[model samples]
Target: MGLEADDSSSPGETVMVVMDANRSRGNVHAIEWALRHVARRGHTVLVLGLLCEIGKRASCFPFHMGEKLERLGEGEVDPTELEEEIARKRDEYKSCLQPFYRHCKKNEVKLESKIAAGLCPRKVTVDEAQSCNTCWIILDSHLKKDKTYIYAHVCCNLALVKGKDVVTLMPSKVILQKSSLKHRRVDDALLSNEPITDDQEEKSITPPPKTCCWYPLAWRTGFPRYFTQSELEVITSGFSEENIVQTQDNVKVYQGQFQETPVLVNCFSQNDERFWSMLRILSRVRHRNILNIVGYCFTGSSMFLLFDFPFMGTLEINLQNDDLAEKILWKARWYIAVEIGACLRYLHEQCVDGLIVHLSVCSSNVIYPLGGSAMLANFMTAKCLKDGSPGDNQSLTHCLNLQEDDGIAIDVHDYGIFLLELITGRSARCSLDPDKEDLIDWALPAIEKGSLSEVRDPRLTDTTDDRLIHHMAQAALLCLQDLNRRISMSEVLAVVRGHEIARPGC
Candidate 1:
């Protein structure tokens, strides 16, 4: 059994817990003792129990173990049948636990239960825990092991497992009823019917403290355990407006540091919750061209993120600020393409969620480093598309409406904008008289007439890479077609890589 605490829990406050249902009644007795100790301290308790063991079958199967027997004689069935069964069992389990649920409800002791099917239990648990104010997890001492994999039996993969104070129930050492489950260690002053005052927050239980390991070079992947507001304040010197670089859409960027390492502080408002949610999801991903989030701070009304500083700034800045454009020579342009393409590939193939659309993938969102390399940043507008079809036009409508759908069409549209910048050396949006604006529309006439020269950047006169430019422009124009006919990121990458300029290290 293990316990977790929010910043404010009293030492003896009761905590909500989750456990596997298969555990013996004796095990439940031990957990009861632990819960009593927690409750005496003034906090309430809740428990969630699983009702089924879910596993994937080669072809397909049903959800409920009991009901699945009916389909056992059959070789296989539709995958949807399996999913439907799982959903049905989950509902039935909820009904079966209604008695306990009602008892807990009447006593003000919150409790929940459900069944989930997936190869990654830890991931599923983490997603669920994030939605609750769960304080701890109590699991059987039996260590579920498979070869080198040791399943995290408690807290599953919920971020709470990162808490330093996590308590583990060692099978050999713990005797549930035999040992004294003392309630003396808990403090009672923190619990109150009244809302928690701002002053009382500091004393609230801080997520168990964590040790940080600093590095000069960025790690390929991994997120910091905790990013406290105080630590960030100290690093940014109170985030004085002098350090402020930019602010838009509820996101504020400030300059800061950890020792000599330059960093950018991202502050967001309530409307920007989706951005933070996207970050939490993306934190699990890693790629050379995708800017990695170092740490994050989430407090009521105030949310901030920390990331490594890039010397070269964003592509938007380079396009608008003439002086910066000179620095982005042909070689730098090639590197950006390679890196961004690699990022798209990783997001498409490596992530379990399938496709990731950079809802706002204009040049402005790509950042370049002075030393070299480029990264795709600002995913607040990004979306995860389960099925990898980029030609689904409705995807754009979904993003605009804040609904869920395959965002491949959105990605193709953004790629078209990126192509325009590469060819015209201009922003995706026109600054020319507003009436004459719109890059896609402005270039459409020339592109359709086959007048490639009218759309080519004059600066490429001496570039031996003209053909490379031509091919990219063609690909870009093709992607600009109707959503039903737009090419996929995979196909676009192939055309870009076909250019001689994109040759290794070019």
Candidate 2:
């Protein structure tokens, strides 16, 4: 097993990377880059080597590949066969990881290694990493030159299952390893489409925009300034536990004020490495419904991502009172649906490239305003197109094509779940009890079975907006489909936007 951390361990300090040991050479390079990047800033790193049997599990090897090979040779079945292969592969993989381990060790880079044997390498790696407060994951793209998906599917599967922040480093298109791979230039995908009107097309097609780096302009010119620990402490009231608004996967969110502006402090568990990339991505994205990243602090190995504090907190808390979810008028409910749809539209179209998927969108992440509107937060579990990298044009094109169907579809599914949450005032996947293992699981059965009114929140039942309710119910049904034939965001938006009521065209 790769390096493992026990229960009492800090969560965000160590960076655990799970990759194919057979591709240890490429992974080793990635680990080195991570270590150097983190170490230069004085952060510790952990590299986990997961050794998983391919095509079959360790138990099946003898019966499958080894037994066949032996029978062809006309030799006796070797009982020690599987163990010998495991031992040999383990040794070979260890040797491959040794050089990088030694380099980090020599530099006092604070690195650790662990080896794990399992059938579900990706799940096992993610599970093991989660025990130590992993906040971000960096994966190498598994696409070969033929444009056929390589390990990209593996990485995507892991991301989909885990719903965490993951960044994939792509290969330069010029170094095409597969002759059949078709990489489109990024500009053609992001700029040439011209989503803006004719008058605005010139502005949209202009030169590339400036990169939004977090460091201040003065610091970019060499005048660096940082918040002193003592100052930060006073500024944040000593990171007061009472300031904490929510906690998820070892991340504690605290509401505070920085220079009289509302700020939410996200103190991560120690082992998370994706903090930088997460912060970078969130900082660059601008959307009304999405939570805004105001500023952040990276002190040693720890990070505190500061965001615009959502005064309303989360829908989970708001609905717990029973009054807000039920007492909120139909107009307010419709307003929320419309606003959230608008937010998704912005994420789909207004971004530099194509769509950015909020892989894990749920009630817990939906923050409602005490008055005005609601917004989505928790980008620690989001993914976006590569905007400024060398092969960005190609990546952008591929991402745009992918968004044409896949990305938007996934988002529509997520938003449909959100709609269900709004209607039922319950989680999409509930675990409180059998009665509520997600509103979808419970209400969906009723919805399918024709208990229309019963499946809806009693709060919304009193309202006589049959067409709107029917449309929303239908949209949710389309979204809940496990197949790719689910409704698209544009389609959902069209239905929800046009059917829903707005106050006197305001």
Candidate 3:
């Protein structure tokens, strides 16, 4: 679901976490709460470590430290020695937070750290929070001593995590909300110091998969809402004709408003069957590049679903409009390729509940948000490996997992078609002319013949990056290979990003 305007949850917001890098003690609970609850895709978690002033010498600072050191009867500290100390301090900070780096990167959220020397924790935390313009700040109760001062002076939402299961949120000046959850047991799988992949290792990212308590596939506090029938009507302006933006597969889509933000309202009949199926899959999935359901309404003989309307409209819209077409340059198209591949990877491998098959993936179904990253939407034909929750129906889950599945092949193949469209600009041109040859028919031969230049979009001939194009074509060809030898989305994503994986050559 898209974030609400005035809500604490929104895209591109920062969550500032104040922790003392000295001891790893009270930070586990506070950081765990921030990542598991408050942070998600399109957000950044900044870990600010404000060093205490306990034995710090004036000679440790930059300028004139040499004079002070000389006056103290010792020569100036070696520049190399100072650098080593800073580096060790940074490594200490990274080790304390290393276990969670895998979680943030996997979810597509940015995880960053800063080291600051300060005299007081309160002043340092407030100054950093203000500068970062963060949406919320979670403090390790052990590190912050002056809670009353922080609560009054901090500019954004503040949370004081006192223990493993308790969090006190200062949502407003007049109200303080406290919530408790089951005692968290950190999974070893998530905390492993496994070596990172080559590309991300320099940044101290852990590449392996991490999950918490089965990733909370079951209904939780942050899941989409169930809007009443009246609520849907008010948002859609009583099904006004002018608001009708599209009609597809017997459903009417209306442009509407919810929480002062634009949204798409989809109306379906009671017996459509697709509604329940879509709801089941969409409810269980969340990714930065996958369009999510914000709210849904089911009443009487009609059903409705709400989605965050892309600020830039569908991919087809952007590619066809003359003014917008120029914006989808080769770089953007390459970015779109990587993003959609990652989105498919999440749906295919990361959903612990069950495998999801998005039956419809095309230019029309792809949305372009303001950030220009493509989001896969329109899951009316989507399905989960199990029809119901695994907790309630374990047999079904086991059965689906044990069988030979074609859903992955189908999605991978569709993604290959998408990559072709990206390079050739076939989707846009084909939409305008009904008689154009199928995208595969038009480009597959050139790709097979190793004539990539023949298939590149005319609009990008001068600006295209040959290296990325080659990698994209390689990944696409891998995807469009014999279904029996089809590649996985993770492999596809790696290739698109110019990584060479021993594929059985995928």
Candidate 4:
């Protein structure tokens, strides 16, 4: 009953059951239940298994040297070996579906198995769902809200199947329970046919009354919690000076623990409106390159925003630390550059609402977590253009007070400067002499003359690849162009990936 091709069955409806192959056993059982329900209704089921290989998507840049170095300690890949690996993956996917095939055969149900590999699995799933006359899509309930939003719009009907345990654990029921069963002894509940004596009735004890605790509606919805002043004080130890990691005019950032989770608390004493606006923007954005906002609090004239603290600190800090600088390999530096470019691309293009402009795209705002890539943070100055509205070209130009192409071009300019810093292993503010304080001015001419070695940092001389060094320098020069001539973040990414080249007015 396994159909590999399109089914022209006009008599029955089609049910698409999407599952992640990497999910736990419980999720597999949930998928089985969904399949049984659809089959019982005399409909055909299409089970799509998503193969999500970390850092192996089509859009991902292949780090051949890094992979080979990790596996063989330094070697080149053989073409035949790579082909064998791909064939092995295909065989493994087929083996994974053997149990599903057998189940469909035993139940006399028609089933089709498909394997999808891509950068965005949800996009692939949506494409598959639209390929046929699909009536309904049954997906796992463990998907994030942003991931599931598209499925609802693309499919005719979508049903989320949850595990039994998840469905049974009702938070309201647990919070509203009136009595505790632990308080009563087993013998106290026993009933006998014989009449009860006065002594037995007097000896019987009355159970203690139950207490009811109230929780806010926000707690149930998954929106940021409205934390009380007392709770904030307790978490940050009354905003102790020792806990403070950074302090600026009217603002202080403290490293604190909330509900046993490490969090960064930013206490602001001014510009409350701006803080709330930033919070709204952060709440709408969900991406790996962006910092995760846990929650926020507003009390009287003071405001606080919570974020998941990055253990390794900011990219600026790492660049300044000689010990850490030596550990950041050439491959890691290239990966970090690409990641920052991707973040800017998401803010400027991929957002569903409209475009977002990060007014500040400097290295100080780039945080390096416990991962190979970097994340962009500090969105206090970000601006967004809502859908269905005219472009904010004037506002963007006025904000930056520059004759740039737009707000996005300003980001490209800042990111270009960041790339220069990454390549030269020097701060953007670092100067070889008094007059050459600006890195862009000092390095642009050299990069234009193809003197990459002269501009590159001496620290990276031993490990740097000349080709990559040249490409990065060329991209940096492109980013430093005039307002109307600078390239977009997407174009910068394309050039960095070697898919495109930079040319003026192209």
Candidate 5:
């Protein structure tokens, strides 16, 4: 229950309200009433706080119980103690009133606070209202019993706010009514159309048809919360162009924020089988050097996979831009090779089920988070070759032989091309140039001649450690071998890490 407002309250007027500082919900509701029923834009809400001393009289206060209080403005009270108590109590009231500050600011209304400790709550409230020239004083429900006393002593118009405690509004239990022993549902239209029998009358009314609020459901492990298509729409802001981070082959990757954590959402135009395969692979895989899935979404005709938003985009972008390339020092470049190689090694050899091949490993698929090592990404073509046997290798035949280990060979070969791009700032394209030597053709001949400068990225400092580049070039040349002579990922990892000391092939 709440009290009535005075008819005299007008726009731009000052409103004086008394409420328990600790009960934030009730105080806000009481102020909301003042804003709506009395004050408007440009008005001022002057909140009055009364900190009563600890006594039998103070126990009557309906809010902020169990707090320490000291006698104020008393004959026996020390002056220093009174000042400290008043200052401390004012700060307490200030903090409790924080919720109102934002609400009042948005409404174009000014809010003020006045906190004082006293023995008589009624006398102190009336004196402050008069001194501030506030004629309409609003009382909290805590002071409902004192409303009569306030109304008589104070000359201003008064209203006692009887706010409903939150607990009082808890949902009540539902009760079911028993059907009559000889009753049945008899619609007027159906009763006139067909005659009813005694047996039918004895039956109870049939329940209404049930409905389902549809969403995707599945049992999964090593995955985050599964989102519906609708949730993804809100996350990506309806998949707007402004949220797009990158678009390849006209397929856009959107960047969005979820729960204050930035995420990248990959969209598919159709419910492609590749999307599910990627989802299944990403859900089970975890590594420091891999861009793991944050969550995923499913729909009738589309799908989405969410990952941690890459801060530094692709390794290709960093190497291609000379201004940004400087950030990737000799140490970072070596770090990138080792980290990506470890990720590939983990996928090719260390899986519990079988070797998983990331067939799409490339510079554009490598994400380099700021200050962190490189990460492997773009698993739309990844396959779980259980028992090291080939599944569908139709698309992989051009670059690999369809052997038991051919799928692993394909990834190893691409990883070599990845290493080449790491040393020489060039893109990873498998096709050779007929006009002249392509990046691979030009670099392979240069490495054999010991002319390392011909293939080194010009953006790198000349004073950098040449030993690092020498080892990387050797690993790349070994990886570029013919399919029959290709080495396993473990050997490739060893060569790049300078553990096996691979020699450049003639």
Candidate 6:
């Protein structure tokens, strides 16, 4: 069993306790005693039971018998029977753990249980211990071969419990100091119910002190600051609907104030693996054109990413409103387009690690901050091109050569659509006319034929500069080229800038 003491005086330090479902009653009793002791100290317990003998399937099958059975339609294994076997094994483990569950409930201990199948108990236990951030491990002294391996590999305090009362302590050298002997002796006394002297009692009542290196590590690391669950709850006002700004797929964006500064909170459900991966990516990336992560929270299974709130909201909202669209003058529109292009270029070429593709680069995902340049948001769908991970909605055709610049060509395609929307003042997916629902299909031909006047927004014709309109249309056309012939962002930026310079101006 693995047990962790929180470095802080906080009560919620997670303690991982590894147990074998098939262990002897004596070993089980000793582990139970250790769990109760830790639970009373205000640490949460995570019990992981190894199912060593279950889930073994035959490696080899007789070809002739298998063929005969397949031909007769009677050789196939029943799925129901396979499920029943798994259920039976799970039930057996659950039954053995019933007493521990009842004990935790009786003592009001925060406890969780998991069953894992593996032949190597040491490897399984070590992996679980590391993942759970275990501060301590309690093992049965009967463990012979795996004991030394677990001791050397697991980065935590180790203890071996034999019979009813024998406990051997091996503290982690990296975490404990020579002075820790006093703390160890005090812990032993507490476990043995020995009367404590005045000095020892005073030490015990004091808050558990944080180690020296903890502060430096947290300060130097460029990782997002970890916020506690309580802080998040208070900031989001218990995640009430009134605080919600937007919802994308399973993620909810809530508006909250942090230290009197407005912030946007992106909450992801426990089951979303993307949340963890995105955190890693966000830590490494910081750019003026990309929305930055202010902080993050990991409480149990749920995750929340805090970002600087975009007070002006999304580009889509502006595009759909006539008054807002008027405020976005020719220069502002051109600036927005150029800024978004720069953002994509930075993601693809300038990131420290490797190329990143913002798969969902549509109008809705582009945010216009109150006093800043337009920036890209919603990186949940973003992927590092170096990893060759496909975007959520990308097809086989679109994902071709993702490690190369061509892999980001699909994003170029989407950006082209954004340009078309900017020029025509039409939604990419919807339009007032049913016949013109898809902007690309309806406008691409006109745009390619240099018929800028025909596809330009009627609302923009009188107010926008004619030269700027023609230049943006031409650039959008270049971005919408055939997949094999599409222009790069560098080239598109050059063309757009060339037009701006060539126009008559002071």
Report every candidate's CA lDDT: 0.52, 0.51, 0.65, 0.59, 0.63, 0.61
Q: What residue runs in model 3 are displaced by over 4 Å at the alpha carbon?
A: 1-135, 138-223, 386-404, 428-434, 501-506
Please give the distance, in angstroms, between residue 266's alpha carbon in candidate 4 and its true position after superposition: 0.5
lDDT, candidate 2, 94-178, per-residue tens: 6766677677667665655544444445444444544664432334333111111212112111111111222223222221222
Question: Which candidate number would show the highest lDDT if scored against the true structure?
Answer: 3
The candidate 2 region of ten consecutive residues with least summed lDDT is 154-163
* Poorest 10 consecutive residues by lDDT, candidate 4: 198-207
Task: Tell me which of candidates 3 and 5 scores higher on TM-score.
Answer: 3
- Report residue 374 deviation for candidate 6 (angstroms): 0.7
Report the lDDT tens digits of candidate 6 across residue range 292-401: 67788877678888887777788888888998887777766766777788778877876646688887888888886544467788887777666444444411223223
Tell me each candidate's RMSD, in Å, in order. Answer: 17.2, 20.5, 17.9, 20.0, 27.4, 21.6
Misplaced by over 4 Å in model 2 are: 1-231, 241-247, 269-271, 386-407, 435-438, 445-451, 499-506
lDDT of 5 at 340: 86
- Residues 331-442, model 4: lDDT tens digits: 5566667778878888887775557888788778888654334778998778765544343342222222433247888899888888887787777656546766678777
Question: Mind sharing the TM-score for model 1?
Answer: 0.52
lDDT of 2 at 37: 35
What local lDDT score does residue 491 receive in model 3, on the 0 to 100 scale? 77
lDDT of 3 at 101: 87
